[model samples]
Target: MLHRIARATTAAGLMVSLLTSFSARAIASEPPAHCRDIAIPVSIAQGQPARYRVWGQLCTPEHRPAATVQVLVSGLNYSHLYWDFPFRSSQYSYVRQANRAGYGTFNLDRIGIGRSSHPASAEVTLESNAYTIHQVVAALRGGAIAGRAFGTVMLVGHSYGSEIAKLEASAYRDVDALVLTGNAHTVSVSAQQNLAQLGQPVGQVPRLAAEVPPGDNGYATVQDAQRPEFMYNVADADPRVIALDIATKETNTLGELSTIGDADAPGVTALLRLPILIADGADDKLACAPDATDCSSAATLAAAEQPFYPHSPVDAVVIPRAGHAINLHRNAEMAYCTIINWANRALGTPPPSK
Candidate 1:
């Protein structure tokens, strides 16, 4: 059974306000779980001065503590909302689904994004983000975040976020499993086109100007008009989702975009021995093109990515008709089920049906 929260007007308003304010902490009574806002102190690079806090929401099942926790990371121009979307959240929220499946989720805003510290854009890179995430993993294991040590930790990421996850898993090898979505070893022509036209300085965008610290010129955001093309398969997406996505869009760094592909180096993923799941939307033009991985089917995608993780068990899935932001598509639930079911099987933790 799905976990559903009562749709109260006041509750909805509170959620909107929290997001609008870009508060470091937000509390929502949705998903019918035990939820709390968290701030884990981290540094841009290991052994460097600790200067930032990675903010996130930690949600767990109501009846019992979760044995495994999934740490979620979103792509560029996205916040934690990519994993726990607000509109029609019952249907679109991966956090709700994971909680129902008996797994806790920590949805984080990467450094330089919403509610987190906004360092100079030039200071945020894939390696720095990975180092910060490594600290977050240690906090989870050491019972520092929510006062409960999670025995099993799974790192999950989307698009550029996936690149960070791959780097963290390879460099630290601390996570028990890794889930990569909206990503692949090859970059598509459409992806290059979309990326080329999407970025603009955040300060120039009126809506995002107040979200970041003043004088932080290193951040960039996608223009509202270009978001649909950059993130959605319009035919398979709802107009409302697109509108909300654009309205709530966050900033990413120039440093990140320049080094986003660093994780795709020849032997980066080869170092991971943990179970890995690779998933992407079937219609994800950003990952599927004539020269990119053949995302026509799950089998083909699995075959294409197999060489990258030669030493680990790898599973791949293609959500039909969905686009790059699969979680926001009408068929998002299918993608959620695919991920949860795969995690259950791969990790050998069968969630008791709610």
Candidate 2:
């Protein structure tokens, strides 16, 4: 795999973009205390590699890199904090749960979001972001940018991030397995209305000015008032968690917004031979409604998903009462355990005791 990456001639070979001395900024400047920022050179276009310092959190079972690693991708307008969730370390943290289960996780801020380089937002589309993800995978595989190597890699993504992961897997077929969450083929009306509220420029938002900066074009962040309904099931969510989520919201480019309908990934997912899992928050207003076609239970979710990945073993689960932002929900551990357990079985790792 490393050899193929090294020899690739067109927009493939990449290098670490941050200084040899990595910057140790926190994902949310709060206290989960296990993540840092690392930069990588992503080939955004042919001969156009740009330095992007993606922020990520790392957690391994025994304080060492695990044999298998999961590369986590957050959905639109989110950062690595989505997985680490500083709100309540005991309940809302997926990173801690995965770490305790003997799995290594590296969750990153997509190229144009978070502390990563703010490239011209117009240039960072789903397709280009997938390439950035591919480079991160290659860097991890060869121990180039991330400083470690794993025997296997599992790609895990939420919402829009799942789309990028699907594209990466389809184009490269480089990872061992995949896990997708808060996603589905059909876009929901509730989500569409919520998304429309974010039409204003990100730079105009008072809380996000420093993060969005002055030059990037075509990027927008959701209005603070619209976040709770758009991201979480209001009745089931903790008001505090939703507050922090809104405070730290990231930006998404017009490229991501405009090009997504053209990048529907069920067809690509169908071609994957790797183990597959599609887990959704059962009450997700944006992606998985209770009345959704086959979303009532895990069996239904699995049944509807089996056809998408014919060559791979497909599994699905609906985390009860949770919404689109599964990790931020009060019952987040259920979703985290679902993912960690599936990843264990899929990658042939020794299963964790239940």
- Model-by-model lDDT, in order? 0.82, 0.72
lDDT of 2 by residue, 1-354 (tens): 222222212111111111111112312322232454567767676567555555555556654447887899999888888987878776777777666666778878888887687777788888888888888888778987447787788889998998888888988888999888987776577658657766667768755566664776587877778778767887888889998998888888888887775446447766678877777887888767543445776656666666665677666777778888989988776677667756766787774333
Per-candidate TM equals: 0.89, 0.84
User: Candidate 1, which segments miss by more than 4 Å at Cα?
Assistant: 1-31
Judged by lDDT against the true structure, how good is candidate 2?
0.72
TM-score of 1: 0.89
Question: Where does model 2 exceed 4 Å of error?
Answer: 1-36, 63-65, 213-215, 290-292, 352-354
The collision pairs in model 1 are none
Task: Give the best candidate by TM-score.
Answer: 1
